[model samples]
Target: MSITIDPVATAGLVSREVRDGSRDGTPTKIAVARRTYDAEQSDLWQAVTSPERIPRWFMPVSGDLSVGGRYQLEGNAGGLVERCDAPESFAVTWEFGGGVSWVEVSLTPADGGTTLELLHESPVDPDFWTQYGPGAVGVGWDLGLLGLGLHLATGATMDPKESEAWALSPEGVEFARHASAGWADAAIADGDDADAARAAGERTLAFYTTPAPTPEA
Candidate 1:
């Protein structure tokens, strides 16, 4: 299930790379991305951390986001804000059932906009990786990143169901297709074979476009 995407084909609105020890202090590895938007830092930061702005772009997130404060995302899981440095960086305890991971989001001011960097790390589980591959995490991030972009540019949020459905649209498919290829290239840049990565990207796209099975035909 290891799918990869070609970042260059994505036109640099988003790009991915594998990095070392940011979430968990280990060398096992993590995937990272840097996305830049036209909005200023203040606007972007508020959109991400403000309750009023949460549901508009992303999900309804509730948490102090201050160090040591527990937070929950409405129907989603809850976790403590492991670290928080206003407008700059924050880390959260990514908990689900008995499993635990960490995710850190950081923002830095650039020439005209801000660079939003995200890092998520899970315990390198072979079984999980085998079933979902990189998209298991990458696809989720892609959604989150899109939320941020939509908020920055349009100052609006998308309906959850609509968003998911949109991901099946032609434009959405193209985005994912290019994104998957980009990730494949990233893995290849990290020493994997280019051809194999390309093939994985194709399989991943097929899975995304495939219709789910229903009961009673």
Candidate 2:
């Protein structure tokens, strides 16, 4: 099982789980985030759609913006757009490799801004859930959405710098800690052992919060 945590790149960002349940092919859920930008939808869409603007907010993205076109980020792998509707909704394969999952993004106009909704769906390893939890993926997406919002609003990019710093912040540490416990509960809900799931969650959080000792060797 692979476990990872990324840092937040923007301020005033919020994220929550919207969907988590069993499905026909894979068990998945939806996570949503809301951010208010001073700009309009047209500019927001460009930041999300245009390659030049992507690195400014999200990862470096390159691919055809049309439906069914393959896309890839420099170090983030590749996927094809399953669907696309200009300035509103778009779907893309969320697969990292080896038949993983797909994540879709839908944009809805809101009060003076836009609401970005993300749906990540695919098969999950029962063992993976028992060890880490949904936050491994969910939290990363949370950070991604935060980056996108900040980019559209301020025309900036925060990658390794913000990611690294966030991993150590008090609030960031607390977030990981609570998120770990929550995901462990979710794993148990999926039929994992209560004790084992909790242990795994605690262990994951410990690993994340633990820092390297000073250079003494």
Candidate 3:
């Protein structure tokens, strides 16, 4: 699929932060992604929280969507909604692949627009962290922010197949590279070994840009 996105500029739209954290005495890592969109706070909140509109930018999500309710994204994680504050913030559990993490999204009005902040907290898995660093989720959020931007600007629904195709496109690869690098820098700022963090970022870049293999007889 052809894309008009300027990989560098689009990738730069979001700011990233990495930090060491914990929950219930267990070690964890927090990845924060923030982006400001040229849209009203309420409209952006609607786009993110309204089930009918989520698929237009993110993935198709189904299930109960209120506090104490459950939600499942068509091909991604799902869990209970732990907290919700209209046009302000919401927190949810992110359960996938036998792992449970936490995600919180908050919106604030800023400079004639709205800024969205996504915070993901995951239990520290030494092996996985060694292999991928924070880019594991950081780059993914970057893409989501980019999609949200497009949706707000054009009100166009994303075609799942085309979205998948765009990820493997040249522009997508470049964007992933930029995001991965940005996360690596954030990791370094968070006191990670510079070389190790950068190497892990490369692994993440490869993970996103590499296509799956096809089985043949």
Candidate 4:
């Protein structure tokens, strides 16, 4: 299946900012992205929070899914649900590979549809940020949001193998390039050095577009 990159790139607004400290006393930074959906708030909420429907768009999720419960996304992060307010907002601790972060999703009724905002806050690792900037995570979420949009609009079910191939395709490269550039602009707006931000964005773009190394025989 083919996916259009432009609409996904232009469909949302993304921002980044640094925060003081997290629950664990680590310095943190946050990336926020918002996109409007043609679905109703309730429908959007259900699509996001429903474990049964998650795999249809995003990834397969399992585990207790409620306030204070733990949930895991297949081959991805797992965390405890911190808060849940039906059809409006939810917050969770996004734990992955022994590192903990926070993610929150909010839904607002807008223009007869729903506006979905995602906030992902993680402890600042100077090396990582310098090398990749927010595009590391922002582009990831952008892809997820794109998948969500496709699922909502046309009930699309992406084949996993095909999806992996698509990521390295020309269309995917374009999408990542645009997303990384936007993140570079956001970083500059957040007081980063313009040259540094642009350099980091270049690194991020290369990281996403380059093919992975093959295993030795």
* Best-fitting candidate, scored by TM-score: 3
lDDT of 1 at 129: 47
State the lDDT of candidate 3 residue by residue for 111-182, as single tens digits: 979999999999999999999999999998898888888899988887777877888998999999999999
Best by lDDT: 3
Q: Each model's C-alpha lDDT?
A: 0.71, 0.64, 0.94, 0.82
Q: Where's the lowest-lDDT run of ten residues in candidate 4? A: 11-20
Model 1 per-residue lDDT tens digits across residues 131-206: 4445556656776787667666766566887776666777667777777777677767776566776776677766
Q: Ten-residue segment with the worst summed lDDT in candidate 3?
A: 1-10
Of 1 and 4, the candidate ahead on lDDT is: 4
For each candidate, what TM-score against the reference?
0.82, 0.71, 0.98, 0.91
| Quality of model 2 by C-alpha lDDT | 0.64
Compared with the true structure, model 2 gives a TM-score of 0.71
Per-residue lDDT of candidate 2, residues 1-217 (tens digit): 1113343333234444434656575666543434555567788778777878777656777778678788888777678888888888788886575665777776678787776666776566667655665556655665566566555645656676666566677767776666566556655675667898788878777767677677987
Clashes of each: 11, 1, 0, 0
Ranking by lDDT: 3, 4, 1, 2
Off by over 4 Å in 4: 5-25
Using TM-score as the measure, what is the rank order of every candidate, best first?
3, 4, 1, 2
lDDT of 4 by residue, 13-116 (tens): 43444334465676788888888889988888989999988888789999999998999999999999999999899999999889888999999998968998
